[model samples]
Target: MKPLNWFRLVFSFIAVTAVCGFYLPGLAPVNFCEEDKITSDCQLHIRSRSLLQNEIQLFVNRLDSVESVLPYEYDVFDFCKDEKEKRSSENLGQVLFGERIETSPYKFKFRKDESCKKVCTKTYDTSNKKENVRLDFLKRGVELNYQHHWIVDNMPVTWCYAVEDGQNYCNPGFPIGCFVTFDGRSKDACVISSGFNKKNTYYLFNHVDITITYHSEESESWRGARLVSARLEPKSIKHNSQENSQSCDGPPMDIPKETTGILNVTYSYSVKFEEDAQEESGWKQVHGDVFRAPQSGMLLSVFLGQGTQIFIMTFITLSNRGALMTCAVVLWVLLGTPAGYVSARMYKSFGGEKWKTNVLLTALLCPGIVFADFFLMNLILWVEGSSAAVPFPTLVALLALWFGISVPLTFVGAYAGFKKTAIEVPVRTNQIPRQIPLQSFFTRPVPGIIMGGILPFGCIFIQLFFILNSIWSHQMYYMFGFLFLVFIILLITCSEATILLCYFHLCAEDYHWWWRSFLTSGFTAVYLFIYAIHYFFSKLQIQGAASTILYFGYTMIMVLIFFLFTGTIGFFACFWFVNKIYSVVKVD
Candidate 1:
């Protein structure tokens, strides 16, 4: 092996081993008991716990409707709010994804059960114009089937119910209300209960049965228990009281399509607890050496960040072409801070000195390449007089957003990252590079990398067909749930395949696995590009140089993003695996 290859391989091996050793032991499964019953079998080891206050607070998150892509804050629908409203701090990703989490009025004492507790009473008088508007807004929210996402102990308060085939499905959110159409058709949550059958009416879910489960920590170190799970069942119950109510049973809270009188909504909840058993399992590893940073660590980190941004954007907006394109651009622009932060953090951890260059490249390099390609495609569209061409003013606005918003945000994020401490590796690097033994054909760099992508490509090629159709064939693709599942599967497959290949290379006494790990999964994009060509010739019927150029141009952008995304996934996975294995191995 060449001197450079020897260095690369040794660095890759060290990095992978370090990560594996540090994190693998933390992946143990948690055990919990059912229905307040804690048998001796259930009393097992538990993870560390912090002392909790007697009071448990429930937080409210944004409300989103399936009928629309937009999400609104919890208070927007005139719902009850905390007297001293406090919002949780949001990360860049959470903010860009439109998550608004705030403190709610619901509070509970640990292990204390309450029944038929009145939260608040909301009255909408149709006589007043402002009240009418608020009522109308609430009714519209019901018509659109907006869902409420409540958070307890950092866990979503799920609504688990039976589905088809005797299976149970748990939804992380619950609908605010349900609407019965004038034609007697039920929508969304209306199907949950048979009482919501009044035609041209809305039924509000004003009552909830909340169940909070916690595991007791018997350790003398901690005083309180940790919450294991939180679940709720929403109901629409008509109540006459404006104050505390003893019983929460009545007819459904229904509003006619056109109401003339005051509409009363009484919110109440019942709370109970279940004790869960805790278990502890143990695995061990020793930390010795730090993973070696690969060559061009700055560029690699930038690519990783960009790829992560694209991956997240794609995951969120897997819909029709128009919405997809619009959302992708906006999301990509808003996500610049994350990209810069990730790139700067990784680059600094790799011991790179050129912070200014790293920040600039993180903000500009990949985006510049994409804009250049798009500009070429737009020129073709303009010359051909195609309606698909973006307007000049729109292009100018895009440039302004890129420079004015994204660039500055990137600078801010990079500055913050530079101010933080670099990531510490448990192991130290060897003074002298280890020599690599002769490699077999299968373990060689090119062959191993090529083989690495095939499994991941196979996992997504079928879904790729639908994605391509959504883009080029003008088909409506709304299977986001399944698409997300496939994306997860692709991640797992890429990680497993890369780890397997990296292990093979390491066993063969070759350490130049750094670039190999990235390219191994990254090569999947090559197959995607080839498939695009085959798809064009075999499936599509377009005849024009401009059109062909436009298709291939956009396809190249997708391919590049995919290359980065998959490569990042593989690289990190291999890095973790190497660190883990090496951490446990006893070295003299």
Candidate 2:
């Protein structure tokens, strides 16, 4: 085991926070002013910019093959904004880099007051856009968003509705949602009336057509595009029933076509803002049905309302990084232990040995170390009374529940193991564990660790950026369903990669499967770190020590949990695969 081998893994995870975190010197800092300090004169003016972009989701071979919903995480503002300054789309360097110029056009700030402890808020309207993605409680739909900035030069603005898009502009993207802007002329027109509401802050998408289609391969347009019913979900608004059917009394749904080969579904969301906020003091918009995803609130809020499932599934949000995360985190934190134990027992039943080793690593070895930082980081948030810190009692309860459920499941798995057959891998193995022949560094576990990261990172780097933005950058993340799907994809990818390497090592007569599983899934933390570093240097510019320390401190917690999550996945997968093969073989 080379020293560099292990160090690289650890390095990749920490480097991002070290550089991109809030405390780094020479960068725009988040000026978070407490509500108390903000005076009646210091009005909180907000501008909401709504816009639309195109996306294409391609399915490769349909089954077993990975799919891609064209990674739309890139900055569309930079992608399209500079066409005016350069007089052409070809030269977009301004919007591409130092995006501060484009966003600075619309600014809002509160008066300085001393009631606050730390004014280092964050790049609130800084990065890509507001995070507003959510999954329907019925577990049937997804909503994605593109944020257009609604800003003014001085006072921070507020918006109750999702005023989206400058539809009348040159090269204007196809308008779907509401299309009201500050400036409709002079190409790069400035904002006169921003996207803000008196008391509401959620985006109000107008002209927003939310289309849901159901198609079967046997249908006419079913080749690539599915032909299904499309209608916008009914909102709390009363619009003319002319465009849609007589008016849906309840939630709108897309039903599958009668024909069948295999079903295909398509959901499209684009927007055009209605006439500017009622020139008076009322919420007004182009009267119509823009298909909404179901929830009009934050991700956590949406998911938290499990009791009001139907209600939460009615509209799209302004952003969704946190929403997407809600389901995944809930699933993992709740299921990690139980699954680990159940899978372990299944392996044992299949004629496996080393039960204690596998169970111990799953229950304690990984989780114990993973959570160590969480406890400490809570202290920072605790002392400051910052929201980042989870209450100690909550932490204790989480631990108690996680272990209470997972620990017993492990024993259940062990018992199940005692009742089942011995193990069997596809091929035979030597009597003793053979010494692996060393090749280049890449061929060893180090290479496997490095190689394992590419696909996982490719699939998740976009989402990861948003997550880091949420945690360190203080951006919201609420696309839990999408995130959950991605999480599933990543789990599959991690397991496959680990299995491929573990199989090779096993064939080579090396039997150190325990650590290898950890290394395989754990490798993702390395890539996460490296990306964090890249984002820090390439994307973020921070200032101050407290922010910096706080940044890394929190990041360590992310890395550690990821370590356990991925490691557990890999180990169980490899364990199951290994046992299936070893147990079924003839061992005379």
Candidate 3:
């Protein structure tokens, strides 16, 4: 009946069709054998070959116990060390998260199976004080059920075993050992086997059964295959004589709680291979236009960096809350350098001239906002004579951490970033801009941004309930694994939704998708804020204005951080998608 409505429907249909058609070819399975063999209905044929000389290296990451928030390097446990140890290069995020991945003693050749191969032997003599101390620390690690994270080919070497109800569970990390109490009660990994019944003893996982699954590609050009998955089964085995033992068998390696004599732990492993039937695939994108500087590029870059810092802080702090407030503040303060670096790099790439302003904004903008809000909240607490009020000394310490440490580090990072050359774009931009076409209601910026966040919010709303409960109701939140999975899902949802809407905007010839992209996913924070208001009234039972002010004030801080985090995710995703499409498509 209406011409505008009719036009909208036709335009939407055309855009969807064009996008699908453009992406469909890349999504389809292609024959690796020959370019001529590639067809619409071509079957994906991965031709893999067994490597003749493949060296599989196992890397040991930082050790962490469920009982403690702190993590330590592998060397702290005094386990068998690699003679020529080398550490893998870690990113800023990994370093901040306390990941210390280094070469381990475990090494194997591809396709060549080994059974009960001895790695190294560790002898702890009680006569030596240092040895005794090391032994005690090892025992403490066992008692606390400290986990060992092993990496193979950049993938986690999972420990898969049967759990309760006969269902199998795969743990990304395995415990250093198990502990048996004086009363004969077993803890952690001790429950996995009935053999760990020895009283007042520590059982060390000195042996491992490693299974590596690889995908073979049988191409004339390439000869070697790639590892798809790696799994290991840890065991505590005792050898009657280290010199005489050929196979890892006899009994569990148990150490007395209070040992007066010498103790030995012989680290060993067995390796096997399995051919993986399926091959993993990834979507490819182009780059160029997406990297093009947007309007208010400097401010956006600063926000992006701050957002990334908040994301890292939130992710790492979620596992334990014993020292949450203090740890989070410390992490945020320490993380300023990375934030400044990211902001300066992006701003520089965007052709920003005022480096000083960009760095200052990056270091101060978001943190200042949070501190100001917190100070206001603290004032309310002080006026109400609440015990929750932060002491003046604590404020001074925070200021010291901010100005004395964070500010200086941020400047250093900014300097480093500015010194580097700007990132090269895949395609060059024209000095003159193209005129954008008239947009319909659906294609408009605000409506599209509003719609972009709904899916991501939908993905995390249930998890948000638990988080809110942990914050307000003082409920213990320890389901970090599930929370992490939900976080990943939220990111995916945000990226896909933002990309889809971005495509729609691009199809409509609306080139101004930069801020829109960030805001599109960032709008999830608005929904989160709305949900908090609903939760405040419906779920929480509060009576005072000060209490309400405190609740909303703290919640606002969370919402702002979340806004930055989700917005950064969406912005980067859409940026990548736009770059990919533009680079791939033929343009005049």
The model with the greatest TM-score is 3
Per-residue lDDT for 341 in model 3? Answer: 82
How much lDDT does candidate 1 score?
0.81
Candidate 1: which stretches are off by over 4 Å? 1-290, 319-322, 586-588
Model 3 steric clash pairs: 47-217, 47-218, 48-216, 48-217, 48-218, 286-579, 286-580
Candidate 3's residue-wise lDDT over 1-588, tens digit each? 654356458769977986776433213322122233433332222323122234677899999988988899999999889999999878799999999999998887767789998888889999999999999999999988899999987689999999789999999999999999999999988998999999999999989999988755552133345677899999999975647656676799989998988887788899998877653111212122334478899999999889888878877676444587788988888888788888888899899999999999998888899999999999999999989999999999999999999998889888988888987555676666655557799999889988988999999999899989998999988777678668768878999999999888776766677799999999999999999999999999999888999999999998999999999999888878766655543221
* TM-score for each candidate, following the candidate numbering: 0.51, 0.38, 0.52
State candidate 3's TM-score. 0.52
lDDT of 3 at 153: 72
**For residues 1-588, could you state the per-residue lDDT of candidate 1 as single tens digits?**
854356458769977996674433313322333324434433332223212245678999999988989899999899988998899888899999999989999988767788988888888899999999989998999999999999987789999988889998999999999999999999888998899999999999989999988766553133346677999999999986645435687899998989898777888899999876544211111122225667888888888778777777776565233466688888888888878887888888888989999999988999999999999999998998889899999999999999998888888888888888986554576656555556778988989988998999999999999989999999978777677668778988999999999887776666666678889999999999999999999999999887888999999998998998899889889878876665543232
Give per-model CA RMSD: 21.5, 30.0, 23.3
Worst 10 residues of 1 by lDDT: 280-289
* RMSD after Cα superposition, model 3: 23.3
Ordered from best to worst lDDT, the candidate numbers read 3, 1, 2
- Model 3: weakest 10-residue lDDT segment is 279-288
lDDT of 2 by residue, 1-588 (tens): 643345456667677765674442312212222234433322232112111101111111100101223222212222212222311122367345422322211111222111101111111121223411111211111112232222121111222222357332221122111222233221111122332221211222221232323222232211212222222321211222233333323222222212123211212223221211112111011001111111222211111111111112211111123354454444444444344434454445333455665555555544465467667667766877788678878888878855886455545544554455643343444344334455455546677777776776678888888877876667777765566557657878887888887776655444555566556766888888778778777767777665566667667766655655566567667767665544433222
Identify the leading candidate in terms of lDDT.
3
